[model samples]
Every structure is written in C-alpha cells, then in structure tokens.
Target: MTVAPHPALSANLATPTQAPAQRDDAPIELSTLRLPTPPVPPDTCVIDVAQLFLDANYAGLLSLPIVAADGAPVGMISRYELMRVFLQPYGRELFGRRPISVLMNHAPLVLSVETSIGDAARAIAQHIRSPITDDFVLVENGRYVGTALVLDVLRAVEGRLADRSTELERAYVRLKSSQAQLVQSEKMASLGQMVAGLVHEINTPLGYVRNNVEMTRGVLADASQLIVAQQAALDALLGGDVVADAQARLDEVETLRLRVDPAALDDTAALLDDTLHGVGQIGDLVINLKDFSRLDQAGAQKADLNHLVASALKIANHILRKRGIEVVHQPGELPPVECAPAQINQVLLNLLTNAAQAIEHERGRIVVATRAVEGRAMVLIQDNGKGIAAENQARIFDPFFTTKPVGEGTGMGLAISRQIIEQHGGAIRMTSSVGQGTRFVVVLPLRAVVREAA
Candidate 1:
C-alpha cells in the first residue's frame, strides 16, 4: 500500500493550487513591457513630430532628460530649447504651421538597455535641470534597440535586491506579455457573444417579409375586384349588351342594369410581386448588418462604406418604417477606408438611425450622401424630423443625455457616435432647426498616418 508518488507530481498534489498572478503591486520588470523599438522607418509618422510638440507641451515629455548618444550620461531638453524650435507663442497653430521634424532634437542623449534602473534614475537626477526626467532610451552595440524609461527601471528594481531582481522582474514581464495576450483573447470571445445576439435581433425583419407577402396577396385581390367591375360596365354600354345606345345614358350601375364581368386575376399577381419586392428589401439590410458586425477581431483595414451604411439602415429599420419615412442615397461611391470599419459603421448606424427616428409624427424623409472632399471622404446623414432645440444642441453629444422615455433610450448613441468617429481620426458635426429636422456629417481622411514614438 506504500507506493511512492513521483516528487514533482506528489508536490503538485500535496500543495494547494496556486492562485494566478495579477499585475497589481508587481515590479516594473513584472509590468507589461513593450520591447521598445527606435521610432524610425515604417511606423513613424510626420504627425509624431507635431505630437511631440503638443504632447511635449501638455504631457510634459519635453523636459524628460535624454541619455547621451553613447549611453554614457543624461540631459534634459529645456523649455527654451523646445520654444526656440517649436515657435511657441503660436503653439496652437502647430499642426497647420510646419513640419515637426524641424523641431526634434537630433543626437539626443541615450542609455544602455542593461544599465541598472537605479543608476539610470541617479544619472537623470544628476543631469536634470527642472520639472522631471521621464525617459532613458536604451541602446545596444552601436544603435538604439529598446527603451528603458526611468519609470520602467524604477518598477524593475524595487526593494532590497540586486541585478538578480531586475532580471527576474524583466523575465516576468516577458512571460506576462504572453499572459496579457490571453486576456485579449478573452475579450474577443465576449465580442463574439455580442455578435451572436445581434444576428438574432436582425432576423426579425426577415420574419416579417414572409408575413407581408401574404398580406399583399389579399390587398391585391380586393383592388382587382374594384378595377374589373368598372371595366365591365363600360364594355357593356359600348357593346350594346343589355344596353342600347338609348340605355347608354343610364346614370348608375343599378339604373343601367349593368352585368358584372370578372376582373383580370393577373393584376393581383403583379401587385403581389411589387409588394413582396418592397418587403424583401428589408432582408438585404439584415445581410449588410451581419457584414458590418463580422467577428474580425484583428485591427483596422479597408472597409466598404456602402455595405456599412446598408447594415446600419437594417438595424434602424424598426424605427424608420413606423415613421413612414423614405431614405434616398446619392449615386456617388467610394474606395474602402483604411480604418476600423466596425467602429465606423457603429457611428454611421447611430447617426442614420437617429435621423430616421428624430421625427415623432407623420411621414419623413432621410437623405444620405457620400463622396470625396478635400482629400477625404465625407458622409452626410440628414433627417427631416423636428429639428433640435437650440438649448439642447450643445449637450446632444454628451454621453447619456437622451430625451427619450425610460427603458427606450440609453443616451449613449451620440456620445458613442463621437468616440467611434474620433478613433478613426475623423470629425462629426450636426445641424438642426426647431421645426425642420436634423443632419449629421462625418469626415475622414482617405489615408491613415501610422504613429510611432521617437
């Protein structure tokens, strides 16, 4: 009965299961490390230059001490240095003012990646003039390889330890990065769950198309009867069947003694075809929506604006039909946008749906136009509903600021709309009148600027 368990397996069974590690209170080395790269070719943006100026002015990246080119020492870029190059009295005009490259300090100080964080911080303290030092780009061999910021190094080395602690912590971060990926994988799973529900919600209108086909058949039958009776009475009076020239003058159906002739049953067939066609359009919208919400969990890419618009229309059809509204799309088309299609579609969906529902009473009209303007594609969704009140216009885009009844609105539509557009480096604007209607316009550049840190 005394069979011995393997040491490793026995220990595994004997000890309680270990809890998974969380990032809180963890060392900098344990913190997520983005093995830094030189902010150069491929990922760098000219905008980064402007971002440097703006971020430097705001985020205080300007004064963070720079390590020497040889990883020997550190120094800070002063306000005077920044202003001399940045042209600061008009900092607000920087984006339209000039290229950012002219402002960047070349041959700035650098540091070795293996340099202990404790020494790096001390080096920064010894060289820093004012405010604080933030970065220490680590170089290896002869070129810049990765960044080892003051903050990152401080986190890497905390408590009574030596180089071993830093190595352990850095190793932990390297391992932890893989773990963080698993966390992202989990979020993707949640998004998949959202899409499943959306698919079900979309099938609703498709179900109604089948019912509408039947209703159209009935209405066509009634319409045919009215048409046939009129024609038959006219034919008899002209043909002199039970009605001579003198009797043709008879006033009404009863007085004329008219006989009924069956109407062409085929008219009902044509009417049914037309009605069914109208109803099937709603189904196409559902397909487009499914396309927009597709589970492409990766990053941004080119997207079909037309297809995206169609899906949003499908999702909003619930409100559009009730208002007896018609949507008109212009003929102009576009190339795919090099941005996040799903997110952009969400914004467009919100705008189009909002426009369709803005009208509380009577039939309305919605117009959508898309085309290139000023090196960017512009999309406009306009609704002829009761225009927005001047008082509420400013606050309309604020999150959770809806005027809808409880349970019917989340007030997040416009706010979410704004965020989605901005994420794509775009702008959205709205125009409205008290008695007329509301209109939303979105503008996004054709090309995207890839951002990198220098």
Candidate 2:
C-alpha cells in the first residue's frame, strides 16, 4: 500500500533552525525544539514507513510522530525499533507487510508547546531510558505539532541550569551587599539617637557651668578692684602722702570692698565647685558614649558585663526618661567574659530600646538583671508593657519583621541582636503574653568560640 506524507509536515520539512536566545527568566517554549517531520498514519505498511526514514531530510530524526485522522498524536516510531525489527532473519518478510502501529511506542513521551524548559527536562529525565530509543512529541492544545530529539531537550535543560547558576550567583552577591547596607543603616540610626540623647544630657550641666563661670568672673573682678584700692591706700600711708589723698584712697578701698560682699569669696568658691561637678558630669557622659560605641576597639577582649550595661543605659537614659520609663538595674558579680565589647554594647542597647518602646503607657517599668551562671553569663530584660501577640512571637527574630508602624522601625534590632549573640556562641530567647508583658533572656559563654568567615 502507498503511504501519504502528512500535509502539514510536508509543507515545512526544512532542517531545524537554532532557537532564538531567551532571557534567563523567560520560559522556554517547546516549539523551539520541534522538528517538523511528517507523521504517518497507523495504517501505513511497516516497510513503506521505513523507506520514509531513509530520506536525507529525516536522517537526523530519532523518531517520527504518528498522528490520527483528527490531528492528535497517537504514538512514536523510532529508528532503533525499526532497525531492531528488520535485522533479524526473515524479519523483513514477516513484518514488512504489517501495519507500522504494531511497532510504534504506545506510551511515548508527549510534551506541550507551553511546557517550561525545567518542566520538560524533569519529564524527560523521569521517562527517558538508557540508550534512548525514542524522541518526544511536541503538541499544542492536544494536537500534534512535531517531534523533538531527546538530546536537544537535555542540552536545553543543561544550558538553562548553567544560566540559572550564574543568575543565582549574581543574586547572592546583591543580597549580601543589601544586607551589609541595611546593617550599616541600622547602626547609623542608633548612633544618631545616642548623639541626640547625649546632647540633651550634656546641655543641662553645660548651661549651669556657663552661668556659674560668668558669676565667678564678676566676683573675682570686684575682689581684684578692692585689693588694688587697698594697696594704693597703704602706699599713700607709708609714703607720708597728704592726708586728703590717703583718705581718698582709703575711702575708695572701702567703697570697692563694700561692692564685693563679704560672702562673695565663699560664693565664688561654691560656684567653682559646682562648675567642676558639671564638667565632670559632661566628661562622664562623653566617656559613656565612647565606651558604648567602642568604635576604636576590634576583636574580642575580656570585658565587664556590668560596665557594658551601664554604658548602654547611660546612652539610652534620655529616651527612657522622656517616656517616664523607670529602669531597675540588678547587677550581679560577674567575671570579665571574653567578647566583642562593641557588639555586646549594641545588643544591650537594642534590648533596652526595645523594652522602652514596648511600653505604651507612661508608667512603665523595665528590670534589667545580669548574673553569671555555670560557665556562662546571662542577662535578663523584662518589661511591663503590652506584649507581643502569640502568633507573632515566633517571628520576632526574623529580619525585617516588625510590629512598629512603618518609618518607625527597621525591624533589624532584635534580629541583629540575636545574630550578634549567636555569633559570640550565645543564645537569645523571648517570653511574652499578649496583655501581660515580655521578657528577653540572653546567655553568653565565658569564652566565645571564634567563627571563621562564611
């Protein structure tokens, strides 16, 4: 029987063209790999179908699609299967006249034109066997489009993987850069807050010190004038000057002395004392700010936890005071623990800030306590405030997760705090109830284990 070529396939029997370059994120269309090979009807004689495979145009094709009268793909006939059938003795005579359907793959791999490259790869990987004997059929809307070599699909998939790997590397670098920026941004924000508070704390003493210095200057001037007048009067008396001139110098001295109150000297001394105290207060604040930041210090060192806590509190005192939040510090005797003091100070300040922010009311109380446990140090911060919701408590440490109104919080404080603690071979945990309160516990090893760069 004479077999007819599929009309649609015969119109486009040219060699396959290379697919156009696709974007990394774009889905690969199966039609890009489709080979417009003519399909044969199932009724075609096996020997006649075999002759079609011998055509130079079809030499590279591993399989030909078999379509039904209505254009639906029914199966595939591979070159391997055809060669296997004809190689045996008397195999040609026995099967040459039989219908090609008898040898066709009943359950061939069929993919849609819309299938993504990754999906297609997965489908082929699952069904493809060793020494691949058959190519897959590409269909659109359940109708035959053309054939696709399994090797082509594999190559497409491999190329896609390579592209994806490159894309992932680029994405990872961007992510790291963004993370670093966010961390620095948070640090700068904290620094700004500390500076504002320190300014306010320093101004109070600075204002008084300025006033006292001015007053002391005036009193000293009056006393100096009185002494000069008295010296003139004494010189006039010793040199036997005219009585009227001596009387005039003496009278001037009395007038200047009267201008300088008897208690003015003592008052000046008191003012100087107060000025020194104010200066000391400013100095302490400067010292505390420096200690809290520790920007000059690097690496790990043995540091007193109490000192760190005090520095953080002093830095955040203005914030707490403005909110009328009372702080109760309970410090226990602790050995100096080896740690990054700057990082620890940051963590402490974050906790203190969080505690203060959590309190929604004016009469809020926060208890900060520290103690040395067996081989470790522990710090506890407890606040009487509206607590975290039960469901949100789990994600409290997740980066960028915040309940604060947008623009008010970066949500990195707790997350960074936890990271710092954990990096020092420590742990941070929280306990909270919706309406009652919240508490955070931090545990640190006496000697931190240094971690290698990731």
Superposed model 2: Cα runs more than 4 Å off: 1-8, 15-26, 38-61, 64-75, 82-102, 139-145, 168-190, 293-302, 322-326, 338-340, 357-365, 385-392, 395-412, 433-437, 449-454
Per-residue lDDT tens digits for candidate 2, residues 1-454, read 3456666555444456467687756788777887877778887888988988887757988887888866788888988999999999988999999988999998999998778877888898899898888889888788777788878888888887898899899999899788767777787888887798889999999999999999999999999988989999999999999999999999999889889997988898899999999999999999988887666554788989998998898889998999999999999989999888888888898888888888998789999999999999999999998999988988989999998888667899988888888989999999998767899999999998734211
lDDT of each: 0.56, 0.86
For all the candidates, what are their Cα RMSDs to the real structure? 23.5, 4.2
Off by over 4 Å in 1: 1-286, 449-454
Best by lDDT: 2
Residue 395, candidate 1: how far off, in angstroms? Answer: 1.4
Clashes of 1: 5
Looking at model 2, the pairs that clash are none
TM-score per prediction, in order, is 0.42, 0.80
Task: Assess candidate 2 and give its TM-score to the true structure.
Answer: 0.80
lDDT of 1 by residue, 1-454 (tens): 1222223223323433232353444433311322332232212223443344354222533332333334322333334555554475655465334433344344454655445445566776775445443354445553444344455545545442665687789999887686445434433433343355455555564565566666565665555554555566677677767655335434444432332223434445665666566556645655665666664722577767766676666666656665688888773577777766766666776677677658776768999888877778888898888888999999998866988776545676677667657766778899999878888999887774412100
In model 1, how large is the Cα lDDT of residue 329? 76
